[model samples]
Target: MRAPARLREDGPLRATLVAIGLAVFGIAATQFTTLPAFLLEPALQGTPTDASIEARTMLLILNFLGFVLAGGIYLSATDRGWSYVDLRMPTRRGWLYVAAGVVGSVVFFVAVSALVQLLSLPTAESQVMDFVGDDQTMVLVMILIVFFFNAPAEEFLFRNVIQKRLYSAFSRMQAVVAASAVFALVHFPVYTAYADSLGATAISLSVVFGGSIIFGYLYAKTDNLVVPTVAHAAFNAFQFGLLYVALEYDIEEAQPAPSHAIDVVLALC
Candidate 1:
């Protein structure tokens, strides 16, 4: 199956608009998926300062489903089917990219953190930090969620769907940049929840943008969805694991840096 002629023949302007529209719809769909989590909130209320594990777990699961729903709908609408996504097991060379992606992501985050601190840029912490508190168990659960569900879902929507859609009218790098921008923009509201100023929000979004570019690039280079998905999952899982260690050992330095918290809720989109 193939996409409609209009979609396949889209000029730059039309492609940009369509890609943005699809991205917006995907974001809305994911947000809508979290609605049911609210129902569980009252029933699963925890301490006043913390969200219940049940509620958090429900939200994570719903988020995964929502992203998958968005991707599925797009494929159906375009008549492209799952085959259009280029999903396959990674080759040995692809595995090298996966390793590079994971390591590069960590290095990128560390470099960005150092730059932010050096420049004294204002940055916002994720609201998730409040809910996580000192709960190592919650952090452990989040690690599992990010690895198994969150990373795969977001990669499917943003990289496989939206980025690939843009390729009809843009260069590979252009598509990656445009899709990364959209990914970062969609995350704005979540970061703003704890932002004290626009600078703080911008800093957080910049990190997201950079990280997304890495994911997009991996997808483009490998032409294998699992490459980026596993890379994304491993990076996020690493952060959550670090947080768990921080909570367990009370190592402040081991805690996620300001923008690093963005990964914690990246799937909550």
Candidate 2:
């Protein structure tokens, strides 16, 4: 009875618990690996040059863990017997969805940037000059990896797996909120990385968590990760492009932006 009950009764809950637990593990792992930078960057490197590299590597590993946990949740919670779906291939309509998401994200991003100023939140402004210098090959490869591969992988994990699985046991709003909270928690490292003040980090995290819930809702309603993934990828790409433009063009100031991802979320029900 115990064995059968464990397999069938509390499967989703168990999976969710595991998912959250693994999140802690992943964060601790990254923190442990990068502790040297936090303590020794100023003394050894004279600057935080290698600090950013460690952060990026940590992000990559976290994403990988997210994929695993999401996959586990999807399999455990859903009745569907399908194995992992290939995110690399999209249908014709999927492409259209991607385009629509890009446009919607841009509008939302610009609007939120303007709106956050009204709240008197301190948003920093800085830019990186191109992704890998003037090398065209590097840019192309980076775009391919980010858009075609990494973005889709993340979307499938969050939307199709974690969000959907949670919705089975939790209310739609609760599921969205949970997924978004987890998403924000996964990004805690970045909060510490770029923020100079605790106040700034708190504000930024609120914005991120809030916006993530919206994205989760959209993903739930659409029942397709393609739209959300495309939006996510496009937003990042635009940000990269913006960084390049700002760094190369010598802008006196670029406003710090807050994410408003919830704008795209319209409940299908």
Number of the predicted model whose lDDT against the real structure is largest = 1
Q: After superposition, how far is residue 240 of candidate 1 from its true place, in Å?
A: 0.9
Runs of candidate 1 with Cα error greater than 4 angstroms are: 1-8, 43-51, 257-269
TM match of model 2 to true structure: 0.62
Going through the candidates in order, what is the number of backbone clashes in each? 0, 0
Across 196-257, the per-residue lDDT of candidate 2 in tens digits comes to: 77766666667667556655665755556766777777766675565445445655344224
lDDT of 2 at 136: 32
Q: Which residue window of length 10 is worst by lDDT in model 1? A: 258-267
Candidate 1 residue pairs in backbone clash: none
Error of 1 at 236 (Å): 0.5
Predicted candidate 1 versus true structure: per-residue lDDT over 213-252, tens digit per residue: 9999999898789999999989988878777888788898
Backbone clashes in model 2, listed as residue pairs: none
TM-score of structure candidate 1: 0.88
